[model samples]
Target: MTVASITDLDVTDHYAEALHEVIEAKAEHRAPTPTTGEEKTAAPVVDLMAALEKSVADARERRGESSGGSEATVHEMPAKPKKKTAAKKATAKKTAAKKTTRRKTA
Candidate 1:
């Protein structure tokens, strides 16, 4: 099998560019236009921390959980592995302690 080249790829590039511009212009026309001549302003910067806190509370409220201020606890989002491992270790220690106490009393 033989592969063929179109000699000048620039012609194809120009057509592609023109077609993209036409499609974008048509799409802009289809969208609703604002009546005011004033330019649309970008949205205000958001405090991500505050927004996340509110979101968590809202979600907890929907789940029928208490959204108390003093009792509010934020769990770490990223998995450290250390936390779960530590929890397992702590549980094991407690069980071991109980077994040792039972053995000593018996």
Candidate 2:
């Protein structure tokens, strides 16, 4: 058996037709009739992140763990002196000591 081409297939856009009918009904201030036999019902919108967080919280609760409410402590590192500055201070101290020794010897 040969397969039918897409051009030969009869396609009907039920959604577009339904939407157009609804728009026209609203303009005429009348309730739109059901375009298809089945009535469309909207599913509840869910927040996936919130749901996952709640699931994790529930699991933690079942395991006898508390929902973490503590704020994280951030540690700030002290700034270090530059290598050149440290080296200069060391050389200055060494020269000062040498000068004192030379004066004592003299």
Candidate 3:
């Protein structure tokens, strides 16, 4: 489609038109007209926590685990301290000797 001028553009806003009609009806002290077609209903509310628990129970049952049986426990171990290598030991000794043998400057 080609437009010769800015006025040729299709700028009809259905929402604005409907709002204007409602305002006019209110000014005349009459009820605003209801929109035609089937009315929409809100979806049923869900219990998320209960649904998740049931799902987990179903999965456990499928996996041959009893609902009231013992559950697996996890224990975390403390990480072992790293041992100093021979090169690191030598570097430490050198650093200590340098600090001890340094002369006081005036």
TM-score order of candidates, top first: 3, 2, 1
Summed over model 1, clashes come to 0
Candidate 3 C-alpha lDDT tens digits along 1-106:
5567756887877788789989999999999897574579989999999999899899999999888856779889999999987664543445444445678899
* Residue 100's lDDT in candidate 1: 41
What are the runs in model 1 whose C-alpha is more than 4 Å off?
Answer: 1-42, 70-106
TM-scores of all models?
A: 0.28, 0.30, 0.39
Off by over 4 Å in 2: 1-4, 38-106
lDDT of 1 by residue, 1-106 (tens): 2234545333345556656767777888864333334478899999999999999999989999888864747888886575444345533434434344344564
Alpha-carbon shift of residue 102 in model 2 (angstroms)? 28
Choose 1 or 3, whichever is better by TM-score.
Answer: 3
Who is ahead in lDDT, 1 or 3?
3
Specify the poorest-scoring 10-residue window by lDDT in model 2.
93-102
The C-alpha RMSD of each candidate to the native structure, in angstroms, is 23.1, 17.3, 11.9
Locate the minimum summed-lDDT window of 10 residues in model 3. Answer: 90-99
What's the CA error at residue 85 for candidate 3, in Å?
A: 18
Model 1 — TM-score against the truth? 0.28
lDDT of 2 at 98: 39
